[model samples]
Target: MLRKVALGSGVIALIPTISAATPVQESSKEPLKPPLMRLSELPIYEAPHAEYGEYIKSKAKAEKNSYLRSVIHPQVQAVREIAEIGIAHTESLLHTVQDNYHELRDRTEWIVQYLREEDNKEIRYGAVAMGGLTGFIFGLRGGIIRRVFYAGIGTMAMGGICFPEETKEIAKRNGALAKQYINIAYNFLYGVKPGDPQLEVKFPELSLPKNVSELTQLTINHWRVKNRSIASEKCEVECFEDLLFITILC
Candidate 1:
């Protein structure tokens, strides 16, 4: 009875200790975020040129006729030129990107040489069969034909080797991408139908720029809000002059 009681007491004590212990909790982990796109990787706005032109024309039309003739017209003309230059700059930038991605310089001439070589191999084989058969049939009479055929085939066969399809495909894709970038830039800089098709003549009153930076500044100025306080003040004075005169007299 004593031993059983002692063992029961020990078991009760052990149960209490086990029940008092804390449970282990797991720490929550945060999800990783997606990488942000670089400026070069971002897609440009569509029909930016058309939108820009419309914005300009709308502003111009809202102005008084004298202001439109004296200021807005020349400003529009200058902005157009600047925007066109900016488009050209964008094209060059895009071309550089494409070249870097494609490594065009490394593959261009080499791939052409390789393709020529593959073509030459086919030509050489064909020439051999044609020449052999012709010589066997007409003996010396087929000499001229055989020589001509052989010469043509030989020239082609002389090429280095066939260019790998992978390299050629990459080059082609790069070229296409470069062209697409240029087109996108064009849409952003010049509307679908620019008012002027030709820009050979420069307008000095517009303060046309000779460099890209100047052009960019001009472009920013083109879209910026104009201060027409002078025009507004003149109209306000003309409209309220009678009221002001009566008040002054009183």
Candidate 2:
């Protein structure tokens, strides 16, 4: 009986030891985490611009509650619409300016040629007067050959002496070409083909003013006043150069 009791006690002690030593079974349902990537191998991530298109789309998707989304959606949409309209109008105006510039450039080809001819004439005259090739070379320094070439414009009402019927026809053609060129340039710059309703979003380097009034003023100053003034100045400078060249030649 004593031996049996001693053996039973030993078995009880061994049972507790075995139980403690046994490895606990891992929960099968627990998910294993993916291994972390090395710092060097980690991809560079750029956050999307808050005001840009992608952010607007993502925000719409993230909101689950219908009430909150409904309130926010209209406001977000309004902002996008405003931006689109503002950008489109600005781009259209810019394209008009570009078309006008090119048209002016096309019209001035004859004057540019005359200036070039006058420059050559001055060089030759200097050579004749100074009785040496050195004088001619030096004279050519100030009057560099300005060769400006423009492709054939369909039609233009270049100011010149012409019959009444011819003048009227030229004016009509000029208007048509002006409209055509403006559309073409605008389409190319904006990347919106004919009949396409979408307006391209542009993120210019300069941030627009937060205030609606200030933004309007800024747009007017740049697109309306400043750009037109600059274009006029350019034309004036060219005309002055042509006049100077003619005077020198004469």
Candidate 3:
């Protein structure tokens, strides 16, 4: 119980920062554009076009040997499949949640119309009428019909006040779940636990406009190779701090 209390307090402390990032300001900014070709984008050029053209070509060609798959073990394949499934599922849920919001708005319009019939008066007068009608319907500690009417009016008014927020909350919840499935599934499959958790692998997301999906996928592949090289060779990767935002492979 004491541990739970501490964890709850820590989480509550984080609420402010989490909420701060999510406000409309984050969405209002324009996306940054890529300025130059990444290293990966450059072709394996001949000597005149590339400083180390011969070395680059021969190196890539050696790695493309037929026996290459022998080095890529089965476990890695399993994890890659899991990541692929997550990518598919998250994208699907994104579409579904987006659709549901539009449906909710349509339902809200229907409720508003039905509400018009229920309250013959305008909203300026309807508040008092609704309050009184609400009381009359439920005041007697009510009959079956009274309870239903009272609930309908109460639901109508409450939805008018809060349904938009509720709809947003629902969509947000679904989106979170979808992202969680992807993040957790990927981490569990790959065994590289998450430290700075964020929604990732947003399809086709890349700094460059052309071939964004391919570029991002290439980065993922490079990251995987870098990860393995580090593990097997005990080689520490240079951070390349200046190029942190840029793709290392490109």
Candidate 1 regions with alpha-carbon error over 4 angstroms: 1-86, 89-105, 108-147, 150-250
Query: Per-residue lDDT tens digits of candidate 3, residues 59-167?
Result: 6787786357667756689999999999999999999998998899899777556545535446524554565466566745868777766765565454444343554
Ranking of all predicted structures according to lDDT, beginning with the best and ending with the worst: 3, 1, 2
Q: Estimate each model's TM-score.
A: 0.17, 0.23, 0.25
Across residues 1-250, which tens digit of lDDT does each residue of candidate 1 receive? 9999999999987884435668788664422333455667655764444555776776677676777588778888899999999999999999999988679756876655654564576754554455455544544455776766655443333321242454347556865786667765666576555454522322234354868899998877766634366667788998799788899999
RMSD of candidates 1 onward, in order? 34.8, 31.8, 43.8
Clashes of 2: 0
Predicted candidate 2 versus true structure: per-residue lDDT over 115-193, tens digit per residue:
3454465643443333333334445544433111110111111222212345457767975786677767767798887
Alpha carbon lDDT of residue 153, candidate 2? 17
lDDT value, residue 15 of candidate 3: 83
Worst 10 residues of 3 by lDDT: 26-35
Q: Please state the error at residue 89 of candidate 2 in Å.
A: 0.3
Q: How are the candidates ranked when ordered by TM-score, highest leading?
A: 3, 2, 1
